[model samples]
Target: MSNKILIVDEDSKIRKVARVYLEKEGYDVLSAENGVRALKEVCESEISLILIDVKIFTMNWIEACLKIRKNNVIPIIFMFNEIENINAVQVLPSVMGDYIKKPFNSEELIEIVKLRIKRYKISPSYQKLDKINIEIGSLTINRDTRQVFIANNTVRLTQKEFDILELLASNKGIVFSIEKIYEKIWGDVFFESDNTVMVHIRKIREKIEEEPENPRYIRTVWGVGYRI
Candidate 1:
């Protein structure tokens, strides 16, 4: 069955456009004009993923995401028109599976949705691990619980960061190009922007590394991409 995606945005135009594109891609699309209605839909229906606008009436996207996370582990992508320092530093990490900056290509958005769904669809058994425990230096990843620990301190990672780390760590010594990483994690190679990957990588490094400038687990390959 096709995955069901719930879109929550204040703009009718964005909702209409996203619905059209996602429907064409064989997804079951549903939409709401604000967080209140979106939360209602989430409670009432079976949704595999969510695309949320950070600014909305009744409740903001962060609040909506917190509410959703309280009850569900469904993947959520947060959309913003501009990336303010406060939003990037505080708001985005709290409530999103991924953040898509606005003026985005429709095709890229569709691909990201597909990638998130694909990740969700993968069963635990498909993961490459001797058991559920994954150790890299002082960092330990518990696959079953989706928890990460770094030298006795529990490192908090958003879902997307964890996925990126897992993908790199799983295939150690392999140089994953930006295009390859986008396709593997976000599900679309069409919108392989360096900034998008950079933001995610920076965030991940901040959480897991002692010094993000000189990282241990995830490392940059210069002209290539990232490796663990």
Candidate 2:
């Protein structure tokens, strides 16, 4: 199937220009005037990536991204007119793939789009799962859907967070160190000083655990690692 990219922007000229450039590279382009329209489009269609404007008038870009992330993990790129000191940080890494400043170079835009989509495709979470739920008390993790729920209410987790949770939950009794967790989830070399896994674990606890200070589900193994 051809890769389809959704561009959400209020400016008709910007959409038209993006479509022209993207179509030349054989990417099917879809355009939405606002975040509401973008949300509707995402639900109705299968999109590989999204290019959204930072200055959305009808709806907030972060809100739009969170809504999309409810069911889809499609890569999202934010567009900015100019960098006003670390503008990219405004777009959350969990919901955002990357950002390109307005009046962006066609090569840069295309490269960013290509890289984000590629990364999403190769991500372990994007691959096939058993379509089963692993239950741990009130928490329910659906592997296939990549969703977490407490009782009946859904809990939002970043892709990495979910992956880490699922890894421990699936194994149940196994203990995975921070290095192992990082290497397994990230598929990369783990630096001795890196606290990436620890940080994500803390974030996951904040969202899922009632009292992050004294967590109930995920238990720290003191000097070793964490377990569910």
Best by lDDT: 2
Instruction: In model 1, state the lDDT of residue 98.
Output: 76
Candidate 2, residue 100: the lDDT equals 86
Q: How close to the true structure is residue 193 of candidate 2, measured as C-alpha lDDT?
A: 88
TM-score of 1: 0.49
Ten contiguous residues minimizing lDDT sum, candidate 1: 123-132
Task: For residue 154, give model 1's deviation from the true position in Å.
Answer: 40
Which stretches in model 1 have alpha-carbon errors above 4 Å? Answer: 57-61, 85-94, 123-228
lDDT of 2 at 83: 74
Worst 10 residues of 2 by lDDT: 124-133
Q: The CA-based lDDT of model 1 is what?
A: 0.75
lDDT of 2 at 155: 86
